[model samples]
Structure formats: C-alpha cells, structure tokens
Target: MNDGAPQGWGAQSTDGVRLQKVLANAGVASRRVAEDLIVAGRVRVNGEVVTELGSRIDPENDLVDVDGTAVQLDQSKRYVMLNKPTGVVSSMKDDRGRPDLRRFTQDWDERLYNVGRLDAETSGLLVLTNDGELAHVLAHPSFGVTKVYIAKVDGRVTPQTVQKLVRGVDLEDGPIAADKARLLSASTGSATGREESLVELTLHSGRNRIVRRMMAAVGHPVVELVRRQFGPLHLGTLPAGRARELTKVERGALLTLARSATSSTPAEDAPDTRDGDPSAE
Candidate 1:
C-alpha cells in the first residue's frame, strides 16, 4: 500500500484543499492533531494511506476514512431519525390533506426525506436525510437493508408459523419470507375477547405492508405494527413523534453500511424503489 502522498503535493493547486485543514474543518481533530494522525498513518484518502504532510485533496470528490470509518466531508449533509407516529404519512406533504412528515422536519433548514416509508399505520425508526446517494442505496430492495418489526396480531402465532415465515410463503406479488421470526408474547384481549400475539420479524424486503400481509397469510392478521430497527439504526427510547440528529458514532456506522452496499453493487444497477408502493411498509 502506498503510504506516501500523491505526486504534485508541492505544487499550488486551485481545486485541492489541504489535507489537515480538511480534517480539521470536518471536526476530525484539531489541525495539529490531524497532522499527527496523518503521520501515524491513520488517515486514508481514496483508499490510499496518505501520510506525507501538505497533501491536498478535493473534499467534494475524494473519499476519506479515519480509523477505517468513512468520513462525511460535506457539512451540509443531515441525518435524522424520526419515531413516526401512526396516522402520519411518510411523505413531506400529503396530497389528500392528511398528516405528513413536515411536522417532524420543519426545524431543519436542509430539505430531508424519509429513507423508506413505514406507511400511515405503521410507525418506528424512520430515517430522514438529505444524502441522496445513501438514501437511494438504503431504500432499494435490492440492497437488502434489514429491518426489524414488532407486530401485534390477531390469534396466537405458533413456532410452526414462524418456521413457515422463514421457509417462505407465496404472496400475491410473489414468494416472500422473513429473514427471521419469533413469537415474543401472546395474550387475550380483555374487552374483545380475542387472542393476540406479539411477534417480531426481521426482513430485508422493502415490500409495502409486508409484515401485515405475511402475518395474514399465516392466519394471524396484524392489529398493530412498529419498526424497531433499520440497518444499524435503532429506535431506542426516542418518544413517538420526535426526531433527533444522529450522533457522530451512529453517523459513521450508517455511512459505513451505505458505503459497503454501494461498493458491492453499483447504485445505477439497482432501481430506487423507496418511493414505490411496496416500500411504504
């Protein structure tokens, strides 16, 4: 691996920004500390270990990594996690005058859109971001970003049912299956006198109303549903209807996941199905 700076480091470049300055501006470290990091061979530019001083790069075009984590060079990029409440649509604006995502995102100046839809009735970890490339890769079904959902469904869900979910079932659209499934708990409704089961399902499909449809196919219709996890993101204890910016660590992990997906599969080959009806679930 080339550990030295690229050629022309001594030349005055109109387009390139100084490497340490870029790292300092990106909040990686102070300029002095960034220089130390570079000298220690901890920084990489375009997958090359760039250790020599006075290195310059195009912040807009170059890929940088610190300690193996991808760094976000653009300061304008925003990542927010919203615990969407039921009855709110995934879109910024609803054409039929229904509740939309604007209420949760009005505070940010950067225009953000949900990475994928959770439908009007389903709620939980919805990612809102202005990073178009990352969003496209994450929401595409072909990328297979795993999502976890907890569903309160009618009737008791059995182990056999879970096995069936894992084994795959024939849906109207096509065959579908859960990556994993488990029955969390079962209880009887006090007023309605009906048995209901709380089941957790992990799936990589971006199909619309998938959990509900899958449960129904197995004879246990979903009464309520909420996504608990998406890729490396978890809803945690964030209250319903509230949104928060992703912490630096969380951002790094998320960016890494996006980078890994795109690196393996070019984004152009996979159609962006996030806005499709199937992604709404």
Candidate 2:
C-alpha cells in the first residue's frame, strides 16, 4: 500500500487555505497553472491530495511543491518606450545586415526588447520594455491597445471610403475594421496639383500589416504609413531617428492601461488628456 499525503496540508493547518494560491506559494507554478494542478488532482493538503478549486493554504505554515519545482511571484519590473524610426528592424537580432533597435540603446544595461514590432518600412512610436508581464499584456490581442496611424494614399478619396473603413470590412482574416477613421485633408502642392489623400485611422487590434491591408482593401493602397500614437502615448513633435525614455507619469499611465486590458474594465473616469508635459528624451 502506497499512500503519499497531499502536498500543502501538513500536520499544522491554517484557518484559511486556498488550494491554488497554496500551490503558487509553494512555487509549484504561476497562479493559473497552480489552479490547473489542483484541478488535475495533483495537489495534496495535509496528507489528502485535493482537486478542489477553492483550496487555500497559509504560506507561513503550509508545505507546498509542484512537481518538485518551487515557484515564486516575480518582483522587479521594467518599462521603456522608443520612438522607432524607419529602416530600423524590430527584431532583437536579425540574420540579415539590417540594424535592429538594440543597436540604438547599446548603453542601456537593463535587458529590454521591443514590446511589439514595427516593420522595417513603418516608422514612429514603438514601445520597448523589460517587464515580461507588461510585455505579455501589450502583445496579447485581448488588450486592444489602440494604435493610431497617419497614412497617405494614392489618388483622391471620397467620404464614402472613410465610412466603409469605420463600418468594418471583410478581410481574409474575417471581418476586421478600424475603430475610427477620418479624412484629415486633401491637398496638392505646386502648379502640377498632384493630390494625395491624408487619412487617419485608429484601431485597437495590432495585426500584421493591418493598417496597410485595410487601406489596400478599400482600394486606397497606402503609399506611406506613419504611426502617430499608441494608446496614451504619442509621437508628438519628436522627429524621426530620435529615441526617448518614458517619464514616470507616462509609465504609470501605461501600466494602468495594461492593467485595464487584463481586467476587461474601462479606464477609470478621467478627463481625456494628452502631453501633460514631455518627460525626457
């Protein structure tokens, strides 16, 4: 007869025990995985292995281990944003001779990488960070971090195109659309009067070549795409080829946005504001 007492439940028991958190306290894995372990009937509290969802453990008293590995919550966090320029590759390293964003920040000691990619041809605000959890939140599709783009398309465009884009259009990837779009202006220079359409599009989904594809889908075919803003951050007057670190306040705002993304909650009610002050460069 082989009887292995459950893991967290020891001779001493605490008044309150949460099965998943107990596993997390023991370093079994992340909270999500710990819940899974409990569901799988791999967790034992006080000689009795349990698969209950509501199990808890007093970290001060409970003995816990997950498949023998100890898991602990992460402490230190880091965040950074870069005003990416054209010709800079988004990857950490490229086998090709192209320059990566890392080349620009050789002096930074802290480990950081692009939170999201900006294709070699695309330019403007790009976020970089060392906080893995934050990065995960920004990269996930559910976050819906809005990205605003200023695009110049060939030929003149009618207002109907703007309406169609805002209404949503079917793409190969199913129905994808811009949250909002508008014709900023239609202009032509010199005596030739060769005109171009300047349009702004705001979308929360960060799909590959989404902005370009959407424009093309509408037959406008973007000739130039510049990301003007990302969520609460904007490129502002920052010219190309310059990079800056996010200010403490800006960083806090970003963190709040990321938290809101995960919680599926709207941002706390506050006045819509931008550029309280430029933090630093």
Distance (Å) between predicted and true CA of 258, model 2? 1.4
Best candidate (score: TM-score): 1
How many Å off is the CA of 122 in candidate 2? 0.8
**Clash list (residue pairs), candidate 1:** 208-278
Off by over 4 Å in 2: 1-76, 189-193, 265-281
Residue by residue across 140-257, what tens digits does model 2's lDDT show?
5556778889988876778999999999988897888789999998777345467778999998775678888888888888777888887788888877877767764566567556
Per-candidate clashes come to: 1, 15
What overall lDDT goes with each candidate model?
0.84, 0.65
TM-score of 1: 0.90
My TM-score estimates for the predictions, one after another, are 0.90, 0.65
Task: Give residue 10's lDDT in candidate 2 (0 to 100).
Answer: 34
By summed lDDT, the worst window of 10 consecutive residues in model 2 runs over: 272-281
Give the CA lDDT, 0 to 100, for residue 121 in model 1. 95
Position 5, candidate 1: lDDT: 48
- Runs off by more than 4 Å, candidate 1: 1-15, 268-278
